[model samples]
Target: MKSVEEADYVIVGGGSAGGVLAGRLSQDPACRVALIEAGGSDRTRLCTVPGMVSIIHTTPKVKKRFDWGFYTAPQPHGAGRRIPYVRGRVVGGSSAINGMVYVRGHRQNYDDWEAEGCTGWGAADATRCYKQLEDWEGGEDAYRGAGGPIAVTRSRDLVPATQALVEAIAETCGVPVVDDYNGADQEGVGACQMNARGGRRYSSSEAFVQPALARPNFHLISGAAAARVVIEGGRAVGVELIDGDRRRIVRAAREVILCAGVIGSAHLLMLSGVGPAAHLRDHGIAAIADLPVGQNLHDHLFVPMTFLAPTARHRGTALHFLGGMVKEAMHKGDTWFSRTVFDALGFVRSSQAERGVPDIQLHCLPWSYPSPNQDRPVRPVVDKRPALTVMPTLIYPKSRGEVTLTSADPTAAPHIDPHFLEEEADRRLLIEGMKLVREIMASPRLGDIVQGELHPGPAFTSDAELAAELPNRIHTVYHPVGTCRMGVDDRAVVDPQLRVRGVDGLRVADASIMPRVIGGNTNAPSMMIGERCAELIAAAH
Candidate 1:
């Protein structure tokens, strides 16, 4: 290979954590950092405009350009189907393509991490990091932060249907309509907060990576896919990169941080012979460290309950919304398009949930469809009639799956088996969640506008019927984590410091290091992890 390009720190994957680390470390001036991203630029409208999100995941041409579009191996318990897994391959990573919803998750999520032996990662520490990262439009409060990079704004310009859904949730779920669910209490209904500013998405690349690029000490290498971590004498030295027909190596003088999300991080570990020994040997890779690299994989799964709403109107609503979004895109300003598609969000406890903690999350969309397909090419097609879809999602799932290599080739996609709904408890909890959402939709406030149940209709009411039908209806919430889980146990791939066990000069940041997936969205927490990782490295240096 050609002479190596060297840096004080080499971070693989310019996603949430990588972007933040690169930005924070480069600020020191003395620390040279190199961020490697597999995807190209995220400068297109498809990555910036909130309304263009659906189009990015649906259109074949657009999807290929931005998304990794990994399909899971057939899920035996989930109707024996192969699920479409959408992860952003752009410079901003999934943060660019994800629904700009910004949720810090419950503080208990981090507390639990500390309880599980991840010291210095409690609720208090996490909150401090969050305050340091966010520039809230709501201004600084006891709980919220200000004057930071990420712009967090509450949903604005809500449509009538969304307002009704929010009201219905409070009335039927016996919860208050709190302005900020990310604040004092999470168990309530209200508008969602998004990672946006002035109608434009503020992805991690925009918030962190962009500024870091201006620094002379920081270098960004795009379109360079990491093949494996170079290990010598049980220490990670550098990374071998595959850039089309060319190959190169980038040396990490201090450390090698993997922020390549859950799947990508685990895949790279196995490719570098850092995973389960037998599994690596199966692919002809000599094991470097035998650990549970791809175990404890889990995620949130939601089932959509579509309802017909007379108030949503029978004609031109979807078209009118699209037209307005196009106009808003042209003007490059705030409009209804700037808001999340599902403006209303709620957190509630299921019947089987632990006291004072919510197990269910509800996302209410103002628009709906007769049939929602997960196939990448044909999805996101909305019906002309005014309809709403309330997705009742299980926030903390007990089900676990794994990520393993289908081949030794780094370019080939890894085998992702989410093993969704395999656990009886997850299946039971989701059914309870669905029942709770149905009650909210059936409330008097929304009952007037509602026509009828369109999907998993009224006829299927009993628990047995719902259980039988779950396999066909359930899908991922796009938050996969725990593949390279950090803890104090034998199964732990990384320790509390996020350093990969048995390997020196290597760490796995991002969602993969999460001992358990947080109760809410992963994007915000991923960024927080990035910030925390930077602090750790800085202090050590």
Candidate 2:
């Protein structure tokens, strides 16, 4: 193996959290930090196009670069089909390739983490870190922060269908209209805030990595894949990297921070003998620690229902090109319409009688939006005809999955078991959510505009029909988390500070460290984790 020089910190995976950590940690100028990413740079035009992200989802060249095109083991609950799991292999990770919805999740979601044995990770504590990394275009408030690297702005355009969907829900269901979903109450209908600026996607790599490159102390190595962490007498020493055919070892002076996301991070831990002993032994790896590394996997599952409209008023159009120009020229600081149509967003409980905030979310698009997994080119579905799509998502899933080592080889992907709809309660809740969305669409405000149900049709009305059809219709919202869970329990992989349990000179800084998946998009929360991890690492040093 080729020996490499040591650094103050060796951060594995330069994704959202890792990018932030690299930027924040190297701020002192005296500290030498090396960020290793398995994928190449985010220099592609496809990466910056806000609307074309789905186009690159299956493109082999693009997928090879940033996406570790992983798949879950055949899920029995999913009708014995293997679900495709797309994770970022590039510098920005999933943030570079995600929908760019800038959601911080419910405040109570964080508080629940603290209550569930994850100390120092409550709403108040996590929000401080959230504020530290955000430059909210919505302006500074008690909940929002300014002057941060990541830019958070409202959508430049609202589709007409989205607006009508919101109006319909509010008028019928009596849900309030919230300007900011990240504000006091998440249970309402409104527009969605996005991580966009100047009509371009602003990923964490663009926000954090690009700015930190000017610092000489920060060394970012792309195309370097970490195979394992080298341990010396129970202390993590460094990492073994496989760059093409070459094998190299880069030592770490302080710690080996794993920000490789949920699957990547947990798989790396198990590969390094940090997982369950039996599993490690079965994989022919000697056990270093027996922490439950990959046990609590969670994700938001979304089922989309399409509806046809009677008129063309709610249809989306490419006319946004003219609107984009106008926004750039006349209303620079104000709103810029990306599409002619509007979108409505809301949150509601699967059961309103249940305590706490809503555990389900609604995103109504005023166009025939294609699924993220679709291979066909996305052409405007209702360029001249009005259409709408109601997407109901299961936010707080009770079903937990696991990530297990399939082999001792680091190059091989781990066996992921998200176990979607494993529990009957999850299925029941989704059915209820679907029913609620149908009711919203049937409301007097939106009902008059609708022609008929476009998907799952009006015939599939029963709960059993919805449940049976769910597996085929539902797709992931791309918020996978809780594999390397942080808690104060024995099964916890990391402690309150995100330091790996029973391990020194090691830590985890990503969504994986979340004890439970937050109720909304994971990007903002992951960025929060990065900011918090930076503070903890800085304090420790």
Candidate 3:
């Protein structure tokens, strides 16, 4: 035991949720807040540039500097391949390395949560929190918020290829172009909104944590991995952390909030002896509570299809694109770098007769890779020829997986089994999304430039063909959720208020608490969850 520190509210993981909670809770002069992050600082320029995201992550070519660099266990449904699971290890967490897309998801997603035993988490509640968190550039409206901590603006400087695709989607897919996807309806083609301000990526660290650094009552502990939560008499008293060569204990006088995202929060709970009793016993650990901690794991998986679009500006090799971006940056500064390549976004139902809501999400990028396989550490070089890629992501996947301990060693990574493409409905929806993309590509605006299909070419036309090849092509969108689900049910690890079941003075706040994964990018929703957590804590205390 090296030393011990104290705080009124001790939050583990200095990511999106943790950052917001710490910043919000520390506003009270009487409260002393502490945030412990497993990773170090995110002061690098790479984290601020949207175009530099791939250079930092998503692509296997880049080294893992700010990423946890964990790999999923071999998925039988995913061609038995151990897919790379990238999560941010820096202060801002995934928001520091993500594509910077800011989507609040469909309003119905939260409404569904309320219907599913999550009281006070309805769409109305979500809207309130979102309004409080956003500083939308589009100005204040019924739904959009303004003058808040997080800056959000729709992409106005769309590249030629992206602009063409956006128009083509409306023309062919019959999906109307909506001004605001985060408003009344999310089922439409829209410009990609991002958390950027003044031509720089605005992560939660910048939006929330950075602003609170000067507060005398707030303390940030970086570069420390949490060994386990310190529980005494069924109450979370503190957390034991491994800070490099030494170990330290951080006591929480008020509460211990776990904001370590899906994988981390669940893993930490299991390690702290707060998971299924049998599973913990198998790992030679005593169980504190037998509540399900790492169940209901789900994620959005997409199969990217490439097309030969000769007119796209960002065509050619990675080096060529980098050189051009660098040259543009030298003259234009952050203007060109702030806009991420995935600028065109659309949400559409897999079948028109199914429902009014969208089941599949679409992302259009004006760039392509040599291979569609995005397996970890194996850099698939970008091609020299011009191309456009559309990734049809299944927003609401039916497959569920779990995260379990590989060993009792806290330093080891957990065994993650997302069970991608395991459900038949999931596979079928992805196929429909692919067919829809083909229809959009065949439109006049895109068809003129699209020379041909690159990956899984025109030959694979039928549903059976696409379904059979899905395992080989599918990749995660990195929007994982529902591991430590929040509900009033017995299987729920946390309650509607996010308080951990069977434990007092502790709570789990992050994507892990989502009873069901939302139907879009998760970064914004995760931040909103953080805001809600802060509000809940403030109300209780």
* Local accuracy by lDDT, each model: 0.86, 0.79, 0.85
Cα TM-score per model: 0.96, 0.92, 0.96
Candidate 3: how many backbone clashes? 0
Ranking by lDDT: 1, 3, 2
List the candidate 3 regions with Cα displacement exceeding 4 Å.
Answer: 1-4, 58-62, 315-334, 352-355, 369-377
User: Candidate 1 lDDT, tens digit per residue, 211-312?
Assistant: 887888888999889999999999999999997798788999999999999999999999999999998999999998999898899998888888888665
Off by over 4 Å in 1: 1-4, 313-318, 329-332, 369-377
The residue-by-residue lDDT of candidate 3 on 1-541, one tens digit each, is 1133999899999888888888899889899999999888887777876666766654554546798888888988788889888899999999888888888888888888999889989999999999999999988888989999999987776667788898898877788988899998998897888898665778989888888888888899988889999999999999999987887899999999999999999999999999999999999989999988899999998888888887775544557657857765675544546676677799887763245778878887777754546454366556556778889899988899999999989989999999888898888888888898898888888757888898878778888878778888888889999999999988999998899989999999999999989989999999999999999999998
- Deviation in angstroms for 539 in model 2? 1.3
lDDT of 2 by residue, 266-335 (tens): 9999988899999899989999999888999999888877788754233244464445456645654344
Q: Where is the poorest 10-residue window by lDDT in model 3?
A: 369-378
Error of 1 at 345 (Å): 0.8
Q: Which ten contiguous residues of candidate 2 have the minimum total lDDT?
A: 373-382
Report the alpha-carbon TM-score of model 2 versus the true structure: 0.92
lDDT of 3 at 101: 86
> Where does model 2 exceed 4 Å of error?
1-4, 58-61, 310-342, 371-386
